[model samples]
Target: MKKRKLVMGTFGGLLLLFGAVTGFQTLTLESRQPAAKPTSVEIDKDKALQHLSEAITYQTISYEDRTKFDFSEFDRFIEFLQNSYPSIHEELALERINNYALLYKWEGTDSSLNPIGLTSHYDVVPVLKGTEENWEQEPFSGTVTEDAIWGRGTLDDKIGVIGIMEAVEYLIQEGYQPKRDMYFMFGFDEEIGGEEGAKAIAETLKNRGIRFDFVMDEGGAIVENMVPGVSQPVGVVGVSEKGSATVELTIEGSGGHSSQPKDQTNIGRIAKAISKLEETQFHAELRGPGEDLFEFVAPEMNLGMKYVFANKAIFKPVIEHILLQEPASAALIRTTIAPTIFQAGEQSNVLPEKATAIINLRLMPGDSLEEVKSFIEKTIDDKQISVSISGSEATKVSSVDGWEFSTIQQAARNVYGNAVIAPYLMVAGSDAKHYDDVSNNTYRFLPVQITAEDLNRMHGTNEHVSIDNYLNSIKFYAELIKEANK
Candidate 1:
C-alpha cells in the first residue's frame, strides 16, 4: 500500500513539474509587436490601377508545349511595358535574354554594396478550355469592376511585375535613388518550369560573375485566419521552397488471358506497391522552416496552443501528430507523396503484361531524391518493381536572422500594420528557386492580403484582385525599395 502511494505521489509531482515548466516557457515567450509604420508614399492610384488592368489584356500565356506559345502576344506585352512605364525604360539599362525574359538594372551610387534583385514572371497560366465561361468576366478581358480588377494574372503574378514597375516609376519621379543597385527580372515561362526563362537568366548572371545580396520573388501572401491561434492576419514569407520529384514505378511480368491469370499479376504487384507506399508514408517531424513558422506564431497563440508550442521540447511528438491530421498542415512538416498518374490494363477483359504508376513527391528541405528512391524500394520491398526518380533537391535555407529578412518583415509591417509577418516553408515551387545560386538569400513573398478563395483563383477560373489589395501591393513594393536601401 505504501509503495503504490509513493508511485502515485511521484507521478503527480512529475506532472506538476511539467505544468510549471510549460507555464514558465509561455510567460517567457517573446512578443511579436508590429513595427512602426513608415511614412506613406503617394502613388497615382488611377494610373497604377489602369496599368495592371491593361497589362492583363495582352494574353502573355505560357504553355507546356513551346510550339503553342503565341510569340506575338509576348512582343505586344513588352511593347506595352515600354510605352506605359517610359521613365523605367529610359532610366534603367534593360537586357533581353533569348528574346523574351527581361532584366532591368537601376544603377546605384554605391558599388561596394551587393545588388538586390526583384523577380516575377509575367507569363500567366492558360485558362482551361471548358472553364472559360465560368469566369464572371472574360478571362482575357482585364475587366475593371467596381471593387476588383478581374482577369488572369491579377493574382498569380502580373501584379508583381506591374507593381514593381509602378513602384520604381513612382520612386524615380520622386527622385528617390537606391543606395544599392536594384535589378528587376521578369521571366516568360514560369508556369511550364523556368528552364527557358529564369534558369537561363541565372546562368547568364552566373557566367558574368554577378551575385546579389538577396532576391525577392512572388510567393506566400498575407492570409487571414490562416494560422489558427493568431487573431491578426499572418504574412508568411517562404524562406525555402520544397523540392519536387517524380517517381515512376513499373512492374513487368508474363501476360495471360483474363480467366487464366497468374496468382500475382503485373497490375496486382503495382497496385500493392502503391498501397504500401500510401500506408507507409514519410515520417512527419517539425523542423527547419516548419518549426520556424510555429516559433514566430506561437507567441500570438491562445494559452492552450502557446503551452504546447512553447514546450515543444516536450510536446514535439504531440504537435507533429496534430499537424499530421490535415493534408495541408501535414505537408508542412514532412515530404509528401501523391500518386499522380497510373496505367495498367489496356482493356478491361485482358490481363496486362505490364503496369506503371507515377508518384509525385514534394521533398522536405533535408530529404533528397536518392533517399526518396531508396525509401520506395525499401518500403515496397519488391525487387521485381523498378523505380526511377528525378528532380531538384530543396534549395538552401536562407538566413531568417539577417537584415535581409528583417527588411522584408519590416517592409511588410509598414504596409500591413495588423499582420504578423512570419517565415514559412513553401510547398509549391516558384521562380525564386532559380535565383538561389545568384543570390545569398532568396526570400519569396507576394505582398498582398488574400483569402482562401483568392488562393484558389491563382491558377483557376475567374482570377481577380481587389483594388485595395492591388494598391497595397504597389505600396509594399515602393516601401521594400526604400527599406532595401536603408
Candidate 2:
C-alpha cells in the first residue's frame, strides 16, 4: 500500500515538473514584435500590370560570354521605358553607363538627407532551347491572363523595375513629393556577375561621394508554409548572404595494372578524403539572422512548439536537432558540402594515375576562407592529396534592430497585411552586396506573396506573376518609399 501511494505522488510530481518546464518555454517564445505600426500607400493596378507586361517582351537576356549578349534588345528596352514613363524622364536625371546599365536620380526637396536607392536587374536568363516548349506562354511573350501574367522576367525582377516605375509615376500623378533624394539603379548584366553593370555603377557613385541611407534589392518574399510551426504567412527580408567557395581535392602519381594494384591507389586516396569531408561537416549553431527568424515566429506558434522554442536557451540542442532534419533548415545553420564533379580512371581494367574531386561550399558568415581550408586539411589529414579552396567571403551582416530594417518590415507588413515580417540570411548572392560599402544597411526583399510552385518558376519553366501580385508589389514599393521619407 505504501509503495502504491509513493508511486502516485512521484507521477504527479513528474507531470507537474514537465508542465512547469513547458510553461517557461511558451513564455520565452512570446516576446518578439515591432513597436511601430507599418503604414500603407495606395497603388494603381491596371497601369502596373500594363508596365510589367511590356517590360517582359524584351529579350534582355544576360550571357556569361559578353560578346554573345545582344545589346540591341537592351537598347529597345530603354526606348520602351522612355515611352512608358514620360514623367520620370521629365523629372529624374537619367544617365547610361557602358551604354547598357542605367542610373536615375530623383532630387528631393531636402538635399541634406542621404538618398535611398532601389535596384533590380533588367537581364533574364536565356530559355534553354529544348525547355522553351514547356513554358505556358512564349518565354518573352509577356502573356496577361485574367489569373496571372506569364513570362520570364515577371517574377525574377521585371516586377521590381516596372513596379518601381509604376509607383514613381503614380506618385508624380498624385503630386506626392519626397523629402529625401531617391536613386534607381538598373543593372544590365547581373546574371553573369555584375562586374560591368552593378559594380561599375557602385564605383561611380562611391567616387562621387554619394553615400546612401539604405539600399533595397530583389531577394526573399512572402511565402506560405515556410516556417514549421507558424500559420501566418512569413515575409522574410534578407540581411546577409552566404559566400560561395569551391574546394578541389586532387591526388596524383599512382598507376598499375588491375591485378598488380597497390594497397592505396590515387582513386582510393581521393575517395577517402571526400568521405572524411562528408563525415566531418562544419559545426551547426543557431545564431544571427537564423536566430532572428525563430524569435519572430515562436510567439505565434502552437503551445508545444512555442514552449520548446521559447526556452531555446535550455533546449537549443533539441531545436537544432529538429532543424537539422530538414535540408533547407539545415543549410541555415552550417556550411554545406556538395561534390559536384569527380574524375578517376579512364579505363575499367587499369588503375588510374590521378584522381580529383570538386566540392562546392556555401560558407557561413564569420567562417573565413583560410580557416575553412585549414580545417579541411586537418580533417582529411592526407598530405599527398592536395586541396585548393577559393571563393568570395560572405557579405557583411546588416542590422535588423535599426530603423532602416524596421521601416522595411513595416512597409512590407502594411502592403502584405496578415503576413509576419521577419529578417533572415539569404543563401544566394544579389547586387545589394555591391552597395555595402556606401550604405549603412542593405536589405534584400521582394514583397510578393507566392507559393512553392511560384518559387520553382522564378528560375525555371512557367515563370509568372498574378496581376494582383504585380500591383501589390508596386504598392509595397510606394509605401516603402513614403515610410522611409518620413
Candidate 3:
C-alpha cells in the first residue's frame, strides 16, 4: 500500500513538472520578438483592380480531358495580354510552349546575374453543376463591385497573373528596370495537373539547361487568424510541397453462399485490414518547413504560446498533442491519410470474391515512396491482401535562410507592413512543383490577405478578392521583382 502511494505521488509530480516546463517554454518563445520594422510601398489600387477584373473575363478554363478545352480562349487571353501591356510586350521576348503555355523573358542590364522566374496558371476550375446559382455574381462575368471583385479565377490565381503584369507595367512607367533577368510564365492547364502546360515548360527550360536563382509560384497567402498565437496576417511561403500517392488494397477469394459463412470472409478480412491501417497510421514527426513555421511565428506570439514553442525540445509531447487537436496544424506536421474509394461485393445475397480500397496519402518531405509502400504492407499484414502504390514523392525543401526566400518575405513585408511572413510546407501541388526540376530553389507564395472562408471560395462558388487585397498583391509582386534585382 505504501509503495503504491509513493508511485502515484511520483507520477503526479512528473505530470506537474511537464506542465510547468511547457508553460515556461511557451512564454520564452513568445517573448523573443524584441522589435518589428514597418515598411511601406506606394500602390495604384485602381489600375491593379482594373487589371484583375479584366483578367477574370477570359474563360481560360482547364478540363481534365484536354480535348474538351477551348484553345481559342487561351489564344484570346494571350492577345489580351499583348494588347493590355504594350510596354511589356515590346520589351520582353515571349515564347509559347505546347501552343498555350506563355513564357516571357525580360532581359536585365546585367547578363552575369542569374534570372528569377515568377509563374502562375491562368486556367481556373469549372463551376460545379449545382453551385452556379449560389454565386453572388456570375463566375465568369468579372463583376467589380464597390467592395469586391467577383469571379472564378479572381482568387485561384487570375489575381497572380494580372497582379504581376500590373506591377511590371507600373514599374516600367516609373522608369524602374530590373538588374537581373525576370521571367513570367503562365500555364494554361495547371488545374488539370499541368501536363501540357507547366510540365512542357519545365522540360523545355531543362533541355536548354536554364536554371534559376529561384522561382516563385502560387502558394500560401496572408490569412487572418491562421496561426493560433499571432494576430497579424500570416503570409506563408511554401518551402516544400507534400507528395501525393495512391495505395490500393485488394483481396480475392472464392464466392460462397451467405447462409453458412466462414469465421472470416474476403470482405471481412479486407475491412479488418483497412481498419488496422487507419488505426496504425504513418509515424508523425515534427520537422521540415512545417516546424519552421512555428519557429518564426513563436517569437512574435504571446507569452504563453512563446514559452511552449520556445521549449519545444523539452515539451515536445505536449506541443504535439496540442498541434494534433487542430487539423490545420496537424497537416503541417505529418502525413495525412484519406480513404477516397472503397469497392467490395456487388450483390446482396451471396458473398462476392473480391474487395478493394483506394487510399490517398500526402507524404511529408524526406519520406520515400518505397518506405510508404513497405509501411502499408507491414501494417496490413494479411498475406491474402495485396497492395500497390503509385505517385510522386515530396519535393525538395527550399532554404529559408537564402536570399531567395528573404527577398520574398522582405518584399511582402514592404508591401504589407503588418503581415507576418513565414515559411511553410504546401499540401497541394502547383506549377511550382514542375519548376523544381529547373530551379535549385523553388518558393511558392501568393501575396494576398484572405480569410479561411476565402480559401473555400478558391474553387467554390462566390470566389472573389477584396479590391484592397488585389492591389496589395500587385505591390507585393512589384516589390518582389525589385528585391530580387537587388
Candidate 4:
C-alpha cells in the first residue's frame, strides 16, 4: 500500500513540474514582431484605382506553351506603363529582357550600398475556357466598381507590379531619392514557370555581376482566420518557398481480354501504389520556417495554445498531430502530395498493358527531389512500378534575424496595425526562386489583406480586389520602400 501511494505521488509531482516549466516558457515568450514605423501617406485613390483597372485589361496571359504567347499584348502592356507612369519612365532606367520582362533601375547616390529588388509578374494565368461565364465581369474587362476593382490581374499579381510603380512614381513626385539603389523587375511568364521571364532576368543580372542586398516578390499576404488562437488577422512573410516537384509513376504489363483478365493488372498495380503512398505520407515535423511561424505567434496565442506551443519540446507529437488534421496547416510542417493526372487504359472492355500517373508535390526546405523520389519508391514498395521525379529543389532560407526580414515585417505592421506579422514557408512557387542566386535574401509577400476566398479567386473565376484593399496595398508598398531605405 505504501509503494502504490509513493508511485502515485511521484507521478503527480512530475505533472506539476511539467506544467510549471510550460507556464514559465509561455510567460517568457517575446513577440518577434519588430516595432512599427507606421508612416501616413496620402494616395490619389481615384487615379490609382483607374490605373489598376486599366492595367488588368491588357490580357497579358502566360501559357505553358511558349509559342502561344501573344507578344503583341505584352507590347501593348509595356506601352500602357510608359503612358501611365511618366514620372517612373523618366526617372528610372527601364530595360526589356526577351522583349517582355521589364527591369528598371533607380540609381542611388551612394554606390557602396547594394541595390534591393522589388519584383512581381504582370502575366496573368489564362482563364479556363468554360469558366469565363462564371465571372461577374468579363475576365479581362478591368471593371472598376465603386467598392471593388473587378478583373483577372487584380489579385495574382499585377497588383504587385502596379502597386510598386505607383509608389515609386508618388515618391518621385514628392522629391524622394534614396541613398540605396532599387530595382523593379516584372516578369512576363510567372504562372507557367518563369523560365523565360524571371529566370532570364536573373541570369542577365547575374552575368552583369550585380548582386542584391535583398529581393522581394509576391507571395504570402495578410490573411484572416488562418492562424488559430490569434483572433486578429495575421500577416505571413515567406522566408522560404516550397519547391514544386513533378513525379511520374508508370507501370507496364501484358494486356488481356476483359473476360480473361489477369489477377493483377497494370492499372490495379498503379492504383495500389498510389494507395500505399496516401497511407504513408512524408514525415511531418516542426522545423525550419514552419517552426519559426509558431514561435512568432505563440506569444500572442490564447493560454491553452500558448501552453502547447511554448512547451513544444514535450508536446511535439501532439502539436504535429493536431496540425496534420487540417490541410492548410498540415502543408506548413511537411511536404505535400497531390495526384494531378492519371493516364490509363482508354477502352472499357480491354485490359491495358500500361498505366501512368503524375503526382505533384510541394517540397519543404529540407526535402530534396532525390529524397522525395526515393521516398515514393520505398512507400509504394512495388517492384513493377517505376518512379521518375524532376523539379527544382527548395530555395535557400532567407535571414529573419536582421532588418532583411524585419524591414518587411515592420512595413506590413505599419500598414496593418492589428496584424501579427510572422515568417512562414510559402507552399506555392514564385519568381523569388529564380532570384535566389543574385540576392543575398529573397523574401516573398504581397502587401494586401486577403481572405481564404480571395486566395481561391487568384487563379479562379470571379477574381477581384476591393478598392480599399488595392489602396492599402499601394500604401504598404510606399511604406516598405521608405522603411527599407531607412
Number of the top candidate by lDDT?
Answer: 1
Worst 10 residues of 3 by lDDT: 30-39
Q: Which candidate's TM-score is highest?
A: 1
Pairs with steric clashes in candidate 2: none
Best of the two (1, 3) by lDDT: 1
Model 3 Cα lDDT, one tens digit per residue, 162-214: 98888888788878889988989999899989988888998998998788999
Winner on lDDT (2 vs 3): 2
Residue 66 local lDDT, model 1: 93
Per-residue lDDT of model 4, residues 285-311, tens digit only:
989999998988888899888888988
List the candidate 1 regions with Cα displacement exceeding 4 Å. 1-13, 32-34
Question: Against the true structure, what is every candidate's RMSD?
Answer: 1.4, 2.6, 3.5, 1.5
Query: What is the lDDT for 410 in model 1?
Result: 85
lDDT of 1 by residue, 1-486 (tens): 999999999999999998798899999999654474864878898898899999999899998899999999999999999999999988999999989999999999999999999999999999998998799999888889889999999998999999999999999999999999999999999999998889888999999988999999999999998887789899999999999999999988888789888888898898899999999999889999999999889998888888888999989998999899999899999899999998988887789988999999999999989999999999999999999999988998998888999889888989898888989999998999999889999999999999999999999988999998998888999999999998
Q: What is the lDDT of every predicted structure here?
A: 0.92, 0.87, 0.86, 0.91
Clash pairs, model 3 backbone = 25-307, 25-308, 26-306, 26-307, 26-308, 27-307, 28-307, 29-306, 30-306
Better of 2 and 3 by TM-score: 2
Give the clashing residue pairs of candidate 4, or none: none
lDDT of prediction 4: 0.91
TM-score of model 2 vs. true structure: 0.94
Candidate order, lDDT descending: 1, 4, 2, 3
Query: After superposing candidate 4, which stretches have Cα over 4 Å from the reference?
Result: 1-9
